[model samples]
Target: MSATIHRIGGREPSLEPMLSLVAPDLNLVNAVILDRMNSDIPLIPELAGHLIAGGGKRMRPMLTLASARLLEYSGTRHHKLAAAVEFIHTATLLHDDVVDSSDLRRGRRTANIIWGNPASVLVGDFLFSRSFELMVEDGSLKVLKILSGASATIAEGEVNQLTAVRRIDLSEERYLDIIDAKTATLFAAACKIAAVVAERGEREESALDAYGRNLGIAFQLVDDAIDYISTAEAMGKDAGDDFREGKMTLPVILAYARGSEGDRAFWKEAVAGRRVADEDFAEAVRLVQASRAVEDTLARARHYGQRAIDALGGFAPGGAKDAMVEAVEFAVARAY
Candidate 1:
C-alpha cells in the first residue's frame, strides 16, 4: 500500500482515536494498576506512584485493550493482564532511568532522581514481581510464557544496549536487534495475548504480534529521531539526552556512515564522551540534517509503520481497525 493513502488531507495523525476506543476498558485496567501497586511499605507506593501516576501514554497496556476489542473479546480477563503489562512497562522505565542516570521523564523528576537509585531499582523489582503475580492469577500457561519471556528479553535488550553504548562502530543491524528485544517484545506480547484470551487461532495472534512489533520499532525510531530535533517541552525529556549518553541510535549510525572524514571524527569524539556541549549538540544536529539522517530515519519509521498497518489487513474493517491504523500513523507522524 502507498504511504500517502494513510494520510488524510495532509492533516496530522493523533492517538486520540485509539485512546477513545480503549478509554472505557482502560479505566478498569487503571483501577487494577492502582490496586496492585499498593503495599505495606510506604516508600514502595510513594516511589512507584511517583512514576506510575506521572503522565504517561500507557501505550503498552492500551495495545492490550485495543487488541482485545479488535478480537471482540467480551470477557474482562484482559483487564488484569493489561494492568500487568503496564506494571512491566513501568518497572522497566524506573530501572531504565536508574541505568541511564536520567533525571527527567514526562517533563518531571525521574523516580531515580527523587528517590535515589537504590529505591528506584527496588521499586522496579517490586513492580516486576507484581506483574508476575498478576500473570499467575490469570492461570494461562501460554499467557504466562509470553509475558515472562518478554520480560527476560527486555532485560537482555538492556544489557545488549549497555554494551553497545559509546561504540562508534555499532551497526544498524545490531541496534535494530537491541530495540527489537528491548522495546518491541512487550508490544508484541501485549497484542498477542488478546488473541489468546479471545481463543483466536495462531493466525490472528501472529498478525497482532506483527502489528505491534512493527509499530514499536517505528515508535522507537521516531523517538530516536526526535531526541536530536525536538525540545524538552515537546519530548517530555531532555532533547540531547541520547547524544550526551552516547547512544548509538539509527540517526547517529546513519550520519556517521554517510559523513565526511572530519564529520566522522566529530562523531567519534561525540560518541566517545569527548564532545558534549550545547555547541556540540548544535553541530551534531547540523551534521545529521546535512546527511539527511533524521529524514531517512523517519523514512525508515514510515516503512515499519506501513507494515504495522498492513498487518491488520486480515481483520475486518471497523472502528477498532481504523483506530489501530491511525495509531500507526500517529506513531510515524510524531517527529513531523
Candidate 2:
C-alpha cells in the first residue's frame, strides 16, 4: 500500500474514490433503492425519503457494491442485495432517531422530528418490509436467512442499548458486544453476501465478512470518540450527544474506569442520573479529554482498523484492494 493510503480528508475523508470504483453498480443499486422504497401509501415513501434522502455517504450500500467488485462479481443480484442492505440500514436510522429522541441527523432535522415518532417508526417498519420484499424477489434463501438474522440482531442490540441508557457502569466487553450487533453485523452481512452472489466458497465469504466486521467496529469506535472531539456540524449533531444521552461508549467506559475518584463521581452525577445541568455537558467533555479517553478509544479503533486491513490479504493487489485498504483508515483516521 502507498503512504497516501493513510491520508485523511484533512478531517472526514470522502469515500468517493472507493465509491467511484463501483459507480456503475452503485447507480443500479440506487435505482433499485428508489424503486423498492416506493409504496401505494404515499406517506410511506415520503416519510422514508425524509431520512433516506439525508444519507451520509451511503457507506453500507457502497460496501456491498465494492465488495462484489473486489471479488470480480458481474451479476445483477448484488444490486438487489445492495438495495436490501441499504433499506436495512435506513430502517435502523429511522428507528434509532425515535429511540434516541434525537433532533438532528446528517446536519438536518431528523425524520422523527418532522414526521413524528409514530410515522417514523411505521415507515421504518415499511422500509424493513420493503427490504425483505427485494430479498424474496432475489430468490436466494441464503441471502434471506442472513439478512433476516441481521435484522433480529439489530433489534437485540438496540434493546441492549436501551437497557444501558442512564447506567454508567457499562463494561468494555458488554459495550463491544452491543456495538457488534447494532452496527457490525449488517456490515459483515453486506460484504459476505457479495461473495455469496459471486458463488465464491467459504474462504472468500469468511474473508470479506471479517473485513466488513472489523471495518464496522473501527467505524463505530471512531464515531464514539469523535462525539467528544468533533463539532456538531462535523458530527451532524452536537458534540457530546452520547454523553447527554448517557451512552457508555468506549471513551466514557475508559474515562470512568481509569479516572480519579472525582472523575468517577462527576461521571455518575452527570450521566448516570441523567443530569441536564447547563454546565454538565461541558464538564463531561472536560473529563473525557482530561482522561485522554477519546485518544485511547481511537487507539482501539486503529487496532481494529489494522485487523480490517489484514482480512483483505487474500485479495489480488489492485485499485479495488488498495481502496479497500485505505477505507479501513478512512474509518478511523478522520477523527484525528
Candidate 3:
C-alpha cells in the first residue's frame, strides 16, 4: 500500500508547538537507540535500522518524554528509558508479524515477510536483549521491575489471543483482558517508569499510569474498529486479515452478540473452519454493520479516551497536557 499520513479527526495541531515540546528529548533518545543498535554484525544492524527509521508516529517515546516533563522530571535518564520503551515496542511488532503471518505493516512489507520468519524472530530477540541492555545501563531496580512485568504480561496476552482465535465463546471480558495485557500494560509502564525516574511518589504517578493504560485500550479498540471497515488500500494490509486469520476482534464479538441465529452459524462455519470466502467477507461486513459493532467500538473508545483525559486531573492544564488530552479525543473521534 502507498504510504500516507492519517490526520485523525481534528484541525491538526501545528507540528511546531508539539515538536518543540518533544523534539529535544525525542532526538536524544532516538540517537541513543540508533547508536546502541549499531553492531559488528552488518546485516542485522542495517535491517534493524531500516525498520526503526521507517516512519512510525513514535507515540510511545513521545508519551514517555512528555509525561516526564509534565511532572518536572529533570533527569536525563528519561532519554534512555524512552529508548528502551521504543525497543520493546519494536520487538513486539516484529514478533507480532511473525505470529500473525502478516504481510504489511506501517504501509510497507512486514519485517517477517521481507526478511523471512526465522530472521525476523531472531532479530526481534536481539532487540529484546538490546532493550534489556539499555535498562541495565540505567541501574534502577524499579525500572527493571516494571519493564520485566510488562514483558511477561505482553507474552501472556499473546498466548491468550492465540487460544481465543476461532473460539465462538470468546467474551467481551476476555477480549478486553487480552488488549490490556498485550497493549495497555507496556503503555502504562512507559508512563509509570517515567514517574519512577523522576522520584515522583505522589498519587499522580498512578494517574499517569492510568492515562497510558486507558489510551492504549482506546487505541487498540480503534484499531479493531478500523480493521473490518477499512479497505486494504487505506489500511496498508488486507482488509479482512483478521477474518482470514480467524481472529475474533471487537467487531466480530459485537456482531456475534447481535447476530441472528443464521448469521451466527454462518460466522462459526466461516471463521472456525478457517474457510472464509469472498462471500464470508461480505457477510462479516453485513453482520458487523447490522450489529452496530463499529459504532459500539467507537462508543467504547470514547469512554476510555475520556477516562484517559480524566486521569490528568492534577496536572496543571496547559498546552502540552491539553494536547495530550486532546490527542485522546482525536484518536477516539477518528471512529467517525
Task: Identify the leading candidate in terms of lDDT.
Answer: 1
Question: What would the TM-score be for candidate 2 when compared with the true structure?
Answer: 0.95
Clashing pairs in 2: none
| Candidate 1 colliding pairs, count | 0
Indicate which candidate wins on TM-score.
Answer: 1
Candidate 3, residue 303: how far the Cα is off, in Å: 0.4
Q: Count the backbone clashes (under 3 Å) in each candidate.
A: 0, 0, 0
Q: Against the hidden reference, what TM-scores do the models get?
A: 0.98, 0.95, 0.93
Compared with the true structure, what per-residue lDDT tens digits does model 3 show for residues 186-269? 888888888888888868679889999998999899889988788886677778888888888889998988888998888888
lDDT of 1 by residue, 1-336 (tens): 135427755778888989999999999999999999999999999998988889898899999999999999999999999999999999999999999999899999998888899999999999999999999999999999999999999999999999999999999999999999999899999999999999999999999999999999999999999998999999989889999999999999999999999999999999999999999999999999999999889888988999988899999989899889988998888897
* Residue-level lDDT tens digits of model 2 in 148-218: 99999999999999998878878899999999999999999999998888999999989999999989998
Q: RMSD in angstroms, candidate 2?
A: 2.6
Model 1: CA > 4 A from native: 1-5, 8-10
Query: What's the ranking of the predictions by lDDT, best on top?
Result: 1, 2, 3
